[model samples]
Target chain A: MTTVFKRPESLKDTETHYCSGCGHGIVHRLIAEVVDELGIRERVVGIAPVGCAVLAYEYFNFDVSEAAHGRAPAVATGMKRARPDLIVFAYQGDGDLAAIGMAEIIHAANRGEHITVFFVNNAVYGMTGGQMAPTTMLGQKTETTPRGRNALGEGAPIRVAELLAQFDGVKFVERCTVSKPRNVLKARAAVKTALSLQIEGKGFGFVEILSPCPTYWGLQPRVAMRMIEERMEEIFPLGRIKEPAAEG
Target chain B: MAEKHLMCGNEALSEAAVAAGCRCYFGYPITPQNEVTAYMSRRMPEVGGQFVQSESELAAINMVFGAAVVGARAITTSSSPGISLMQEGISYIAANELPAVIVNVMRGGPGLGNIGPSQADYFQATRGGGHGDYRTIVLTPASVQEIVDHVILAFDLADRYRNPVLILIDGVLGQMVEPVEIAPPPAADLPAKDWALTGCKGRPPNKSRSLILGENELLEMNRRLQEKYRAIEAAEARHEAVDAADAEILLVAYGSPARTCRSVVRKYRERGYRIGLFRPVTAWPFPSAALAECAKGASAVLVVEMSAGQLVEDVRLTLGPAANVLLLGKPGGEVIQAGELEAEIDRIIGLHKMKRR
Candidate 1:
């Protein structure tokens, strides 16, 4: 009887190429909703990474530039610097942000570039056939780590939000998830807050969304969502990791 | 009014970049090219521009990629090893058809060889160093003045063609100081960048991408790129030929080697030897047609380089089998001395005479 749920105008009507129950679709919807609420869709520039979301440009109803793998932050830095009037953000996966692109993410965060970063940490390399990503949890099996991720050899899963929180240049850092409806609401809020900080010209803002990768995790969509709720959340704890100090 | 000052080649190029309306510069500090980075760090902010000392060459080039996508005149500088690190981003810039200027103040390499000047990257610069079928417009600037001039030209050509332009210099040209008259910024009218990703605003959203998974789609993209390259080769092939009309031997060189070969050619000509110099300014297009025309009157072509027969391969390709193209190279961080080049030329000439007899 009431029209409540509908697609955000900032999101395109095209069908997404994401796998069934993939967290990317949820995260994309959250970003689109935030962009729509802010009424900045016309001036927003999104940078798509080389991971599973490489085709993110097709789904967002705004100008998007696809960057080389792990170079999204640097690209976002360029976009912001070249046109500070526009809003810029980089959407990257764990492998694209924490591994090959580690240098780019760290330095961009350190430089305090006035841009937002939407980091989708699914704990495994989803696009490249479930390879062992830098955020691959210990004892979690992946294509590269068929016998499960060995802590002694492959090292521990990188806590990117915690790592970036230590940087002084960062104004805000939050870790949220889209495992359930409530968590999705929190992620949407975090995304909105991060974008708001960029609008206010505060500093670099980062939101790490612990997404589900059912195809790469070798589980059903519901099972992967449960895994994120019970297991992945323990490894990568949720909540705000950093925030700017209050003005005196 | 034009300003004249005694400046290092690196600094001169940085100043020229500012004059050419490059507002964003991203660079990492690498030897011999550090001056450009340092200069831009100070000058850019002073002129309401942005300068970022990126953590690595990889980040710097990607930053340039980002700025160029917004239709901003952007630049990055690095040395041999640093440039190697930037190959991934360069390839991306080429595939995306973004206009950015890159300066490679080359040093000896295979792996962190030395800080001395070297033209060993001629092949890397002219040929596609990064993976993919793409070409960057490579300009070899020999002197501080040419470095200044080409820095301005590199930006214009990059925007003109919507592709990356590389200024391939070496440590000597980067560090050497010379009194150069910085010209007024050119008044070349460039087309408005209506395709840049500045935001959809009043139109349908635009996507800037290089990845095409579909076979037909990828083929069409490559076809378009090849057409652009062919157009560039036809129009942008640039070289300087001196006394090539009736020369007995033509010396082919570029960058620093060209500067040294010029004096060698002069000394030989003063002694009544019909020797001439042919230097390629635009190295990527290779100036093949110009080289062939210059090689017509000459009995043989001698390619003197700092690398082990890299440019010589291009010379041979351009001149074909009928033309005698010989290589005289000094590898392993060794700059080709004028006297050594002279001796090689005389030895080759003597061998030619013996064969004729």
Candidate 2:
């Protein structure tokens, strides 16, 4: 028997510390694969956000920088501007991007900085132990919203992809889920698309991956998939919301 | 042969930057210094360089940080209020030990000061405006030509020391137009950056950053930085002392206000007042030796500034209590007239003569 799939060279051989069945590991592998496929592994610089992915530098073989919480876009902007030839990306979680870094990410896209952004939307804060997130789904139960997220009390879940799609500076914007094997493949394509946009010298490209935190979601791998498939997709429909127009 | 051209102080700085091999500029629009950005915007594209108008002062400075990380010849200009917004990125640049030039065509300020020539930011520029135990080499350019030469020198010194250099001009110098000879362009063999993050492909992943986590590591980094600062002090301290050989009185000044004092020096020299002028070129390392030398046998030292005698304290530190130091300043939006400065000079001379008699 032979395995057709192997980890990308961009990813380190070290084991991930994420919970078993966590989608972060899957998304990380996808990003690494994209970086390798695009041949940008050596020229790629990754910015790790202040989240569970804080130690993302340890996992990626490429150059990595740690940014203050919610300031990854600002850091990425600096990295990209300083070395325009290098491929830079930010790996951020919902709590990091939507909660604290909303302004930074929005402004980065609005400014149309030529870089890629990989946003992981897991509905709840994973590193801080299942607290409420800006993207936490309504009626979803969490440590902070124990009786379910009350819309009137906690406000509504933020749709980052939708918000960023409105900005003219954003060259590419897409949302995909990693709840199942099919959607995982879709996410890989999305990641590739975003990276290719940057490679083509197009402005800001973003891919929002709806991921799952099994331990925090208090569900098994299969049950989490059901949650993502049934509920997450309803909240965040998949497909490209913005794409660069063909120059005639 | 060196070429001469007529230009404003801001245009001279921009032309000199191009000649000095600068290829990138990221800045925001601010008053009294819009000319710097406008000049760059017109010249950069023609030379295949980058000129970006960043969204805010915060974004512009960070862009400078980005460009500096990769060893691109980059700079940004802003007025006093914008400079305040750039303190964080400036601190980051210093902490990382990246080489870049920053032009602060300063205006009056503690907050939102008008777009006029003022030395209020003397303390902020000289004593590390940002929150960090670090220092930036600040150059005060009084004339349009100095602004041009200093901007080019700033890039060289920044790269030489791998530290940020601030070209501290003021509204008067920035807005003033005069005859300036554009320096010849640097040779094509300008220094190349090996530490930049330009694709990390040829190198073994060069990591140029400022994050030191452990206490011991942080302390060691600080010590190393202090050593670098000392080396910079020894290597790049610059000042100008005029007609101090047989002078009885010395006038200490810097920036645009120093230009006013230069005129006063000429007038007093005609009236038989032997007053010399000491202009600090590098405001950070200052010109302590030059100031000390100028005050050697002088009976009195006068500090003329547009601020509330900020540089006076620095002069006092250099001259000690032996010299009778007096501050002649016109703070709060009033320009220091040459006649006012001359009167103060005469009064000081009259008082010293009375003391002797």
Candidate 3:
């Protein structure tokens, strides 16, 4: 008998608390698979952010620390710097990464901390009843943006991958989506590359996953995925934003 | 390593932390405490330790939290405003039961107050500062030599209890320069942290978190935390009672103000006033039992602090109407003067004498 598909050993076999049609479960499995593929599960230390995935520690079958809101990058730096032998990564949402934690992310990148960052960009604050997030599209409607987000009043969406790539300390920065199976595979590859860079002792590697939040986006699960491919992809172009510096 | 050399309060404290096996220091530059950050940047590399001048105090404390999560001895130093910025992380660390050292060389504050020394943060430090029912072990060191000794003790206490230990000082102690005797590391070994998140290699995974959504579960956690605090209160209250027995006037104080009160005790006792000084070292586990016992025979108990009147509340609560509690609290970054305290003591004595007649 052949068992081709099963859960990754790095992911705990249990039910998660994520909402129906959310993209967090897919990304969590992708990370677990990536951890198993690299054989770094034993050495990996993950940091969970204060968001919908705050219970990531329960899903991740590895050591994990829960960080205060927007402080996961700094926490990751501490873990990595204390024991460089450990592979450390921070799983953050847009509210945790691009907004309140802007300084921590930018400075961690600027400092060239040998760690990985998995930034999930869902455009709206999912856990907090769909408030307008820093990455929310200019005209997107949210709880706070009742009429629609206005460029003059609220500010445009942030391109985190592009912003982080400008720093010399960052070794790799990529923006990918999990809108479709093909896009999911690409995002998986990007996650693997980011983790591999950390194993190789290359400094900061960041992957911005343009994830779907159907409940917050006020769309059906299938429609949310389609919208990510349509409107979200148009604003946040998916591809490798920055490549690792070439080896000599 | 001179046996006895002059050292600044900030640098000596930094040096003592490294000697106490602290290898990771994350801090932001702030007034009256910048010397601590400056000293760490220069000393850390030499000792093969890590030093990070974090982007903000928030990042610095979180870095400390991160380092401590992995069983690393980590510390972060800041002043009043910087410490305020760090409250969020501090609350998390305290609740998570992680071991870390926090040094607050406090300056005057209500909001961006001034770059002068004050102990107005007594309530903030003693009452857990941030929004929570957690408590931090606050150590008040009155001198450079004491700072050296207490910083070392702070690390051990933090690790032993699996909680954060705060070294509370102001500009007076943090900036003072004096001869200090830096001691060798203690003979006792640090307790093994079986719960540290050093990776789940060949073991069950360890998760460090404080989020408990279950109503009953959170109540149980809070009950367990209260039990731990009760154990700490029983085991760790420390105080120094100088010439307190058989005295009519007992002076209670901490930090540099305690020094002024000590001087007042010495000078006034010679002039026929039976004055004494009680200094609380561990301010959170605030030597309350010893204080209540010491205040029994005294005609009056006076609390001298650099704050306006925070410590007086505790003294009054401790004594109730059984004793007369007076406060000589001076705010605005100024140290309480010995002369002023002495005059207040004379007036209290005069009032008592008239009441007896």
- Candidate 2 chain A minimal-lDDT segment of 10 residues: A63-72
For each candidate, give its TM-score against the true structure: 0.97, 0.88, 0.98
Q: State the fraction of real interface contacts model 2 keeps.
A: 0.33
Q: Give candidate 3 regions above 4 Å deviation.
A: B354-357
User: Which pairs of residues collide in candidate 1?
Assistant: none
In model 3, residue pairs whose N, Cα or C atoms come closer than 3 Å (at least 3 residues apart or on different chains), thus clashing, are none
Q: Which has the higher TM-score value, candidate number 1 or candidate number 2? A: 1
Q: Please, what are the lDDT tens digits per residue for candidate 1 over residues B146-224?
A: 9989999999899899999999998889999999988767588887788898878899988899889886999999999
Model 2 - which docking category? acceptable
Order of all candidates by DockQ, from best down to worst?
Answer: 3, 1, 2
Q: Over 4 Å off in model 2, which ranges?
A: A1-7, A13-26, A48-58, A65-84, A92-104, A122-157, A177-182, A211-238, A243-248, B185-192, B321-323, B354-357
**Candidate number with greatest TM-score:** 3
- State which candidate has the highest lDDT: 3
- Model 3: per-residue lDDT, tens digit, B1-357? 649969989999999998898999999999999898889999999998899999999999999999999989999999989998999999999889999999999899889888888999989999999988999999999999999999999999999998999999989899999998887676556689988899899999999999998869989998999999999999999999998986688999999999988988888777767778889998989898899888888888899998899988888887887778999988888877778887898899898872321
Runs of candidate 1 exceeding 4 Å displacement? B354-357
- Interface RMSD of candidate 3, in Å, is 0.6
Cα error, residue A160 of model 2, in Å, equals 2.3
Better of 1 and 2 by DockQ: 1
What's the DockQ for every one of the candidates?
Answer: 0.88, 0.41, 0.90
